[model samples]
Target chain A: MMGSLSGRYAIVGVGTSRFGKLQGVSTMGFTLEAAKQAIEDAGLSRDQVDGVLVMMPAIMGEQHGWAARVAAYLGVEPTFSATMDLGGATACGSVQTAMAAIDAGYCHTVLCCFATQNWPQGVAMQLFGSEFQVPYGDVGAICLMAHIKRRQQYDYGYPDELYGQIAVTWRQHAQLNPEAQMRKPMSLDDYMRSRWVAEPLRLFDCCPNTDGGGACIVTSAERARDLAKPVVRILGAGQSHSSEIIHPRGAEQRSLGGTKAATMAFGMAGLTPSDLDVAQIYDAFTPRVVHDLVAYGICASEEVPEFVTRGNLTFAGRLPSNTAGGLLSEGHLSGFGHIREGVRQIRGECGDRQVADAQVCLVTGYGGAPHEAPPTVSYSALILAR
Target chain B: MFAIEKPLPRANEDTAPYWAAAHKGELRLQRCDDCGHVRFPPSALCPRCLSQHHEWVKLSGRATVFSWIVVHQSQHPAFNGDTPYNVTIVELEEGPRMHTHIVDCPNDQIRIGMPVEVVFDRVNDEVTLPKFRPAKSK
Candidate 1:
């Protein structure tokens, strides 16, 4: 019965603002630009969109009733609206929430969008427990990610060069993407020589904060068929959150909440990992790509080091991933770029970065405060097909 | 030159007891009376059994280093002078992992599975943080 819901809804249109450092664009300005582009991309007027879901940027400081505010700004009074907070997972989560609303007949078309004016804020510092974590100087997501990388090194003994290889591969893809932020060619040496943000996690390993926004219009499959763009069916969607205050003893240390989510998504789609033509795994950090590759069943844990080092994630590799350079090379829209890339890839619209014969694509989003010991990490997955 | 004040941990009702025990130079955790599960950053009920009846139990201050990171970048101004300090996670013998600093150990020497023992750092009159150092030979 659960599988029956697969492919009932589709992403009819996707849009993104110019990504990179910019002057004078407010947060709502980016949102309105992306939303307007998406609405136009779908060949629909503002009045046609009856639902809105918004994810506020973490650095901007959250606002109350943000979804309603976004709706009001757009001159759209959405009947089904909500503001979602899942961190990086919010983009994919918003899409899934839109699908749910459309399935329940609450509304026909839903607009999901996120945008922010980039600034150098310690977004993760205040999230640590004031008593336990803050006192110990455990601030920032990079520190927590460094701990996970250290743990992985101890357990799997993978070479540190594996991370460098992943970084270089994504950067190479970025060079082909005109809109990518850091399009300069990066060599493995450049990656190794990069300054450390936290030991084992270097500057290149972290995604650059940029001013950007992304929006997508989701509607029922039947309605999408009439839209201007090709209907990219939502074959499967799954989300999993592991809220642990501290890393649980005897639990798999490397299991970062993606396995269960992949199981559910792939199950709903009646497909397997090998069937995917492309993937857009979240790349907040380079090691995250490795962890998600293993966690999503794309490859076994032991095989990931060699799989990534041997260029399996490149556009010409067996499984082309993050074709538009991902959050690492592409501008960070907090996984919204991943969603837009997935939709565009399925529609065969990407000029140079497009994968040949791409029919199925997978997009994943991950975010949370790892220091919270609720180690509250959330994973969201979407399987989009032509 | 004026020294910047470091941020202190704010304790709530659920975690007040843990801070109080640390102030007294003793390591304590909440153990569920029903399932005997010990938890830290204390919660109101047992996660394993959802039992509200729990006791404040003293612990062996012994732990093993689970993972660690050296700070090359400080997010807060107060930590600017402590560049390249080590923040560690140590798993207690009783099965709870915690975030603390591993004192008196060089950042490069810190390794996973290193044996450690807790030491209290009294930052102020009210707050005493539980830290760790390399364990001496038993």
Candidate 2:
């Protein structure tokens, strides 16, 4: 049963704390700042928000029960609350949950917030590594994706240079935005000459460790129409899981769960890949973007190389993606960056990197390395319309 | 006995047998008695049939590199001296996969689908690691 949630709820306000190394603030501080800003930006008082969805900050070893903590900090008696821990995928998942809850009349105004303190604190091992993975020196995030990309290169005959192209595009996109962390212009030569963090996956190929938070206020469409900002409708939401195998023992380098999630999201929205005017896709790694592009049916696996080469991901390009620079250059607020970027693009609030006439924006979040449960890895997609 | 200071696997209730076999210099995998499906990283239930009844069976040790990554940097202090090591996932001949390192081969020469065979290394009295080297024969 494909139950459509098209136009049932909308994101009335979006706010983010300063990205990059947030040294002075704790996770709670960042979350509170973003949450309050989001509520105010929606033209709603804290009392109006009767529901809250929070992403637990694990990078700082933050304790759980974040929903209750955040609710108490904000002094709101929420009717509905939840704490999501899907790694980087938490933001999109929270948005999906908030939309469903509002549609079900659980609550009218809900605040979805997430904060990350992974900047100085390296969480590569704690976040992705399992018992089997940690002991074997497969602890780094770059190592895991590098292994995956190596397999992709072996089977698909795709050159590693394709990843270089992706890195270059994001660096260029980041250079235009003042909020971007790494604004240095990256030429293909610069990308090639960069040191390898893991073989075949160079330094530039990985997203910088980030510390920040972002929050969005989701409300019913009728109530959102009376808010402060232009309403961006939550057209569809979906999530899926692929192989639990961290190292899939096969030649196939594609992602199954991501594709399933994308398909479900498009199906629920009654939209196609072409209907998307912009994509705020997760780019923790360049290869991830490639796999996600194929999984979302934006292009076939075999055609990824040519597709990436021909279609620029910049604001001036055909299918603009991650116009706010993405995780590569933008501070990794986890998936919150992607979701907030989608909202901003649809609202035409992005100053220089905004995609023109973007009516429908696709936002996806992916995280975790594979394990027995694929425990941490999750894929969540949101299709938003202006 | 040489000191084995590196990180070693601490076998739990389900994985003790797999480790015991490794201590005996033998490679074993869990096979579901119900569905006859084999799996690695020994678990309580079979991935295929979800049956708890399983047996630890010996493997041929013959495998091929499914994928590999060279670690130029490491967060673990034990691997500080081995920064340029190669970690690989090899598909065993018995249709199961294991995480081990590819040794006796240059980092530059390691290729995907390259044939390899297991070489057990007793790191400590309590632990023995299963590593892979270029296979002499298929």
lDDT of 2 at A20: 79
Find the 10 residues in a row with the least total lDDT in model 1 chain B.
Answer: B39-48
Q: Tens-digit lDDT track for model 2 on B1-138? A: 444356667778988998899889999888899988888767888866789998899989999988898888765666777888887888888877666799899999999889999998887788888899999984
Per-residue CA lDDT of candidate 2, range A1-386, in tens? 54556877899888888767767667888888888888888899888999999987766565778888999999999999998877678888888888878768898888999887654344343443555665677765666678768867876888867988888888888887888888988888898898888787888888887777899888888888888899999888889755533424356423455878998899989999989899988889888898788889888888888888875666666689988788987868787778888998899988787788999999999875443322346888999998
The two-chain DockQ for each candidate, comma-separated, is 0.75, 0.56
- Any runs in candidate 1 off by more than 4 Å, and if so which? A120-130, A249-256, B1-4
DockQ of candidate 2 (2 decimals): 0.56
Report how far residue A282 has shifted in candidate 2, in Å: 0.5
TM score of chain A per candidate = 0.95, 0.93
Each candidate's TM vs. the true structure?
Answer: 0.96, 0.94
> Which candidate should be chosen as best, given lDDT against the real structure?
1
| lDDT at position A307, candidate 2 | 82
State the displacement of the C-alpha of residue A56, model 1, in Å, after optimal TM-score superposition. Answer: 3.2
Most TM-score-accurate candidate? 1
